[model samples]
Target: MNNNSNLFLCKATRNTYEHRRSSLLCQVCGDRNARNCFGSVSCAPCKMFFRRNLDFDLVINKCIYDGNCEMHENSRHACRYCRFKKCLTVGMKKELTRPPRLNQKKRIGKQITPPLIRRLDLLNSNRSKLSFDQWSILSNVTHVYDQISPLPKILNSLSQSSFPPKKRLRIDGATLADMLGLIYRSIYSFLERIPDFTMMSIHDRNLLIERNLHNVGSTSGLLILRDGDLYSNYAFCRANLNTYGSDNFEGVSKLLNRLDMDRVAVKLFVVVLAFSTCFDVVRPSNMTNNIQLSKSTNRLHFNTINMFHIQNKYIDMLFIYMVYRYGYIEASLRFAALLFTALQLCVHTMEAANIQEHGDMLDTIIADTTRKLNVEDDPVV
Candidate 1:
């Protein structure tokens, strides 16, 4: 062969090699720029998608098609079943996927020492009277509560609002839904972070949420108002009035004004309310009619003994902490007052839920939350 022909053929071979190297495609979705993930060549999105849905066998079985739908970059998200099937077909290894929560804990551990660890040092110095377990519960619950509380955000928003702080701001249905949704989401997120709560059976978790989330949320709302100095803010009171009506709104404001605003005590009390089997507080006989307005119809088949055990831990912690903070006699009076306030909050929440617009909004939020929790609780293979 001539010299020029030899050079031309070499150039063609080099060009082909570069093209092949640059065109790496995801094995599962045929997307370019792929890299090894879970033992297979995949794009970032497919990697995360596989990791999230790894244990959801039911999702894979419920394919809309014959379970062989074509999966490419454009069509991958259209059918999760086929996408997941293709991931497996292409040699993706479930064993290579890590538990996300474990990874999250590792990251958190590296970033900052947990509050429980700090409290351990205090216990060693004999400065703390609570047992190690009680301290652990208190630390975990308070940390999670701080992380999930919407008070700061609400205060910032209120500060920046066009209306004056003292002006009575009108709240429409959409505004009410958004406010309620935010509070409910915060409560659910708080519960999800508590290891004991999340460890419960999915049935029990959903049951607890349906029966008691709003009651807990009502107390949460009161705390936000007390802490944010919104109880007397005409705008806030007016908003509550629009949603809960005159009597209930006034009662909520009064309850907030009466709270002593003990941060730790209130946080523990919120956790206590969360695990309570039922809110059995004194109210007028006429209030019994409102039971029909509640959205939850499913009777509790939860492990009553186990739940009571968990709840008792928090109740004990609260009592001990209150005693530590305020003497026994005062703590007893304060505890009784807290229970009465909770009853009032429960009554007010029930009245709010009875409103047609509020009821519909709450029903939607509950349905969506339950669906998401079900997805999270799907069994791992």
Candidate 2:
């Protein structure tokens, strides 16, 4: 608290080594803290500790069961796996360093965990979502009408302090061309609706909107739009393409068509975005432990279950965003998308009742909206 005090109050070790050598890091972990706290990189464990427990939990449980909790870097022994999990939740890459393979050649490389593998697959999974399960069961559900529109009882349930603790998730995706088609339509509709003047020029808007469209197609998910870098391309697209032909109409149309082929990328962006909305992905620490921190379940097991529920309500939440982030997504599109998916599964179980054509609350929305909008303005409305 005083100027006399040093920056790092060392309890175990100091930041400098005895030699004349110095690293661009603190002796303890590398990098300066009281400085670039966020940008500073340390070994895996320390990074995790800083990320997860920065605020400091009032009630931290120690892992006295066995000082087995590795203190290699950021291992905060004062808890269950919560500290480590917090790190990843905060964006610390666990497998960042890739520990060396068995140097002795005496044994095979360490087997990777399913969760870790799942994480990798999610990050780099490029499989085709060429087919979708029967749509009839999943249709009636809509993000606005079914799950997200109203403040659902479930969300309120979680917020209730009087309620018993939060329950862990138990339950828990693709079709590419159709996926791209839907997202493209949404983007197209979004662009078409933009007022003329708000744009630097229609050409400028077109390129930005076009690139936005292309990014979605290329990534096949709505999250594609979130990347600031990709969206900027639209600005340049209009500037360059406009100059290339300066109002050449056919050139513009050709560009649209060129981007259209990236429907896979766009659709993938939506799919992934939909998945996030469908699930919390990152389970809260208390919630995770309460639910059973099955070390066996790979990282994605958490993400999978989170997104699945989100899908249950909207089934179309992410798709809605891909189509049009203007309204539904800003409003918890993913939450509904996942819930709708669940509603479909519920239909399967109630098959004897023939629940396929029977629409849920979402039908009410369509009916209500349809009544107000006349035929001429109907589509726009």
Candidate 3:
């Protein structure tokens, strides 16, 4: 394929998997092509088709009810709007845009400002490189969104909620959704730093995310205890965990079990390990201190120093959010600070992975991705 065509494929694939947990299936046709997307797993033809539509921002489609378009399966090639909408719903953020304003470096000026206020400014905003995108999206949408989607209301309520002034480790209450959000955000940030992997084709990248989500979400045997009331107590973790692992995935017939094909955690871990392995960053086979994962009731406990480093940073964001949600407004600012620190580490971790180890074909990528985004500097056509 031509360089531009290759670039288009990579950008489409990247956008498709953005912000999605691996377990979330493909939006277009629900094909579980999280990884190893070639041959029966996913044909090159289909991938090319998807990219072509994305490259041109042609979301609407009119299916003939025949197998011709072959848009995976049951894909509503009939409605560009619905197809694109579904794509966004599944994880693609249609950030295909124009030139972004140069971020003014505030610290560039020596204006004497109180350190606490400056720090608080960073905290209120998610310390994410993707912050620009977040800000743009949040600013564009009003408090109300498409009536069929509840995401707008939820996000608005969250933004309206106040952050506690103090910091502390919380355990009184926590919700799974909060946990999922923190974890998802952290991982995405981490992955973003890896410049090497940043250039991967969409199918390969999505596979890593999809499989890892399955692994983490499907870990069985661990009990997730929840909030209690006068009558009895509810175990949100247990319930949610059970729900995540309920899908029957047994009898592996391929290198990847068809049933449990795309476990997100497993996929994510594999990619990280692969990236590490590719660059020879961390070697389990060579290291004396490295420990292999253990399986109990077929689930890794996910206990590792790195996990502790990552989890400790934001688990409290979860704890605090839960506490406040259940009526504890006077919570602490500990998690806020931790998440801030974690956000920095998250970026470093991704850079450490550097998906670019795959190749140096990165300069061309920004332009294509920008064009898919439809910005001025980078023209896709």
Best by lDDT: 1
Q: Flag regions of model 3 displaced more than 4 Å.
A: 1-175, 216-381
127 Cα displacement, candidate 2 (Å): 22
TM-score of each: 0.59, 0.20, 0.19
Where does candidate 2 have its weakest 10-residue lDDT segment? 167-176
Error of 3 at 196 (Å): 2.6
Tell me the tens digit of each residue's lDDT in model 1 across 324-367: 77756577889998998898777777878778877676667667
Model 2, range 258-339, lDDT digits (tens) per residue? 3322232233233333333222222222234535455423322323343355434333433433334233222245445433
lDDT score, candidate 2: 0.31
Name model 1 segments beyond 4 Å from true.
Answer: 1-128, 159-171, 280-299
Which TM-score value belongs to model 3? 0.19
